[model samples]
Target: MSLNSLRERLIERLTPAGAWTPDGLPDRSDYDLNPDAPRSPRTLRPAAVLVPVIARPEGASVLLTRRSDTLASHTGQIAFPGGRLDPGETAVQAALREAREEVALDPASVEVLGVGDGYETVTGFLVTPVIGWLAEPPVVSPSPDEVAEVFEAPWDFLMDPANHRRDFLEPESGPRRWFWAMPWRERYIWGATASILRALHARLYGDEARPGAAVGEDAA
Candidate 1:
């Protein structure tokens, strides 16, 4: 598909009022994406992540970040630029603010597309993904305290369902926890971030694609 068609598709998916979990998009394991999928009972805090799509002449790509290893939580993980919402902030506001704080991405450089579904993480975060479109790539410098690196991943690779892998781990005290993970080269984009991407893919491709991968690992 051409970039225009892809952009149109995103617009269609995001333009509606509260377009997050449209008919085709999957919900959290809490919302019955699968009855059998394990759900987290821990209290979930509200957070927002910016899904920044940089529109390029050749193709569009989504910008991602690697969290600084020094952070207390989710350190050294591949993630979107985001964090817990501040006092009385909307998802868009939080997302934009977090993007700016983490990666030095100017909010003015982004055109708000719309929001996507609320993704609940096993780590106890109710994450709202705020999608944004950038006419062109902007200069983004990582904040050393929060971000270890900032890079772009092809939208086509992410939107493709074939790249969505089923990953799971068996904890010593409970049942196996299954989550989506998209391994791009060496980086493991898994957990809530990967699931959110899968939700977007579900909305875009629906029944047109089939799953093609599974990987396993041990968890504590």
Candidate 2:
């Protein structure tokens, strides 16, 4: 689908309350924050991330960040621009604010299409993925303390179902862990970020392709 068409469909799917978390998407319902779970959280919060799409001269790409190692959680990980939701702030507002703070992305330049279902992380966060279309590319500069490097991956690469992989890790007799993988360039996209992307891909393109192996090489 064209960028415009995709944006419209996402908006239609997300505008209604609880639309994103409709009875589809198995993972949406299975998430639990029980401390007994292997990856139980010390604390959990509601958060949002902006899945910012830019119409680059090369093609359409989604902006991402390699987080600094100093962060307490998910350090050195590839992540979307987002964080915990503040008091009185809506999920969309938190996403835009976090994007601007992390990457200098101007909120005014983005047109929010809609939000995907909330992806609950083992780290104790209910993360809402906000899909947005950038009307024009803005100057992007990573915040040194919070972001190590800012990069963009082709939207087509992420949306393609053939690139989605499901991996399991047995954590010391704990629950069998499941996560999605999407390899692009030198980066191995996985974990909660990849899971959400996988859901979006499945929503946009039905699950016809078989799961593959993790993108083994480090894209760094």
Most accurate candidate by lDDT:
1
Write one digit per residue (lDDT tens) for candidate 2, span 185-219: 79988888887887776565453343121111101
Tens digits of per-residue lDDT for model 1 on 61-151? 8899999999998899999999888877777888999999999999999988787777776566788888888888899999999999999
Please, what is the whole-model Cα lDDT of each candidate in the order they appear? 0.76, 0.73
Clashes of each: 2, 4
Candidate 2: where are CA atoms >4 Å away? 16-44, 170-176, 207-220
Instruction: Give candidate 1 regions above 4 Å deviation.
Output: 15-26, 30-43, 207-220
Give the distance in Å from residue 35's predicted Cα in candidate 2 to where it truly belongs: 15
RMSD of each: 6.8, 6.2
On the 0 to 100 scale, the lDDT of residue 218 in model 1 is 6
lDDT of 2 at 4: 57
What TM-score, computed on C-alpha atoms, does each candidate reach?
0.83, 0.79
